[model samples]
Target: MKALVTGATGFIGSHLVEELVGQGYYVTCLVRGDSDLKWIENYPVKKILGDCLKHEILHKLTDEFDYVFHLAGLTKAANTNDFYSTNATGTENLIKNVIKYNKNVKRFVYISSLAVGGPSMDGVPLCPCSPPNPVSEYGRSKLQGEEAVIRQSDEIPVTIIRPPAVYGPRDRDFYMLFKMVKRGYLPYWGKSFYSFIYVEDLARGIANSVKTEKTIGKTYYLTDTETYSNEFLTDTIASELKCKYIKLRIPKSAIPFIANIIQKLTKTSIINSDKMTELKHTHWTCNCEDAVNDFSFKPEVTLREGIKWTANWYRLHKWL
Candidate 1:
């Protein structure tokens, strides 16, 4: 077996690469020239240096793989156009080139975001048929990317996985939560329910999608069986880290002002007014019944176990 992975240097992609290699597949990573290789430095996978939007690079990469995991995407940007250009347009470019060059590829797994499908109401897991109601520009762009993949599905075998708030070792986003817990404080804005998956479990689910016949031309939400409230998640992490924290729930009206200050201080769009809308959503759970039924995609890691493992990694790396 052979595979081509975009965004192979990222948190989820790096784990997927390791999973594929362990499964006896020869993997090739499509990464940007400046991508940090700390996660995959020891892997034996071949690296193809190029941007996904570059037609020649995509064409060349499409010629030599039996499977493609399209994970490269822009999650945060100062402008909305940047999101669409990289996530939506870049996905279209990769799929088109694959159709023209790699007809024998077994599957093209587009690793999409749960943001594209938005929140579920009242802790209900959003199913495949649920109408998309994206809250942020980043969510909208991801939806466009899903559409792009769907457009080429008739000609190329494609599967889409919408993963929710994934966390594990080597993950940077949720690392902040562990850090906050270590700092003896956790801030909450509003009550919300979220679905989460350990990164390794998510990678295993993606790898299984390739071998499962029913997954082609379908979308699945790869999440754990349970949904957790924001407060419960905070408490769980604090317990896992063996730390005590002053839990503060800021007023909803003050979040926008706080987000502005953080955005300015970090000089990053990750914490902006656009992201504030997503933070205020009440539910982010998704249904994984279809995945369980067809792909055997059962996520084995529990929240407590996952958090404990992640916290240990932080400690080992001297990050906490």
Candidate 2:
């Protein structure tokens, strides 16, 4: 078996590549010229350096693989156009090229996000069956990408996996929480709840989807079974760090103004008004029942265990 993984240098993609190699599949990583290759430096795999949107590069690479895992995407950007171009249009280009050349490719797995469902939908479980009501440009673009794959379902074996807040060792998105816990300072914003899956668990789920014949033309939400509220998550992190928790709740109305000021002062896109808006209003929980039933996808790590592992990684690498 052979697999081609796009975004093979990213946090989730690198883990997927490792899992595929362990499963005895010859893995070929499709990476950009400037992408960081540090994560897979020790792994033995073929590396193809080119843009996913380019037909010449994808034409050559797509023909040689039995499976294509499309994980390359832009999560957050300054504008909507960039998001659409990279996530939506780039996905369309890849799928088109694959259909034209790689007719024998067994599977094409698309890694999407729970963001496509927006912050919350009343009485909806945010399942694959739920209609997408994306609020942000990131979410909208991802939905568009998924649509592109679904449209080409007749030509390829397509599967979509929407993972919620994946975290583990070397994940930078949740590093701030680890840092806050280490420093003994953490904040609880609102009545928000979140779901997370360990990166390894998500990778396993993706790998299984490729192997499982029933996964074709189906979409699955890969997440931990339980959801964690802000208070519970902060407390767990504090306990792991052996630190005291200080709970602070800022008014939702004031977040946008404060976020604007902070963005102006920092001159970086770290904490902007849009992110504050998302943080204030979003309750990111999902239903993973379909994934569980179809792929036997049960998350192996609990929140506490995963947090401890993440904190340890930070300490080991001097990132904390």
For each candidate, what is the lDDT?
0.88, 0.83
List the candidate 2 regions with Cα displacement exceeding 4 Å. Answer: 261-270
Candidate 1, 2-110: lDDT as tens digits: 9999999998999999999999999999888899998888989999888987887776765679999999998777767988999999999998888888877788999
Angstrom error of the Cα, residue 97, model 2: value is: 1.1
* Tens digit of per-residue lDDT, candidate 2, span 249-303: 6777777888788777764454666566557665778899998888888789998
Q: Which number leads on lDDT?
A: 1
Candidate 1 has an lDDT of: 0.88
List ranges where model 1 is wrong by over 4 Å.
Answer: none
Q: What range of 10 consecutive residues in model 2 has the weakest lDDT sum?
A: 266-275
| Candidate no. 1 TM-score | 0.97
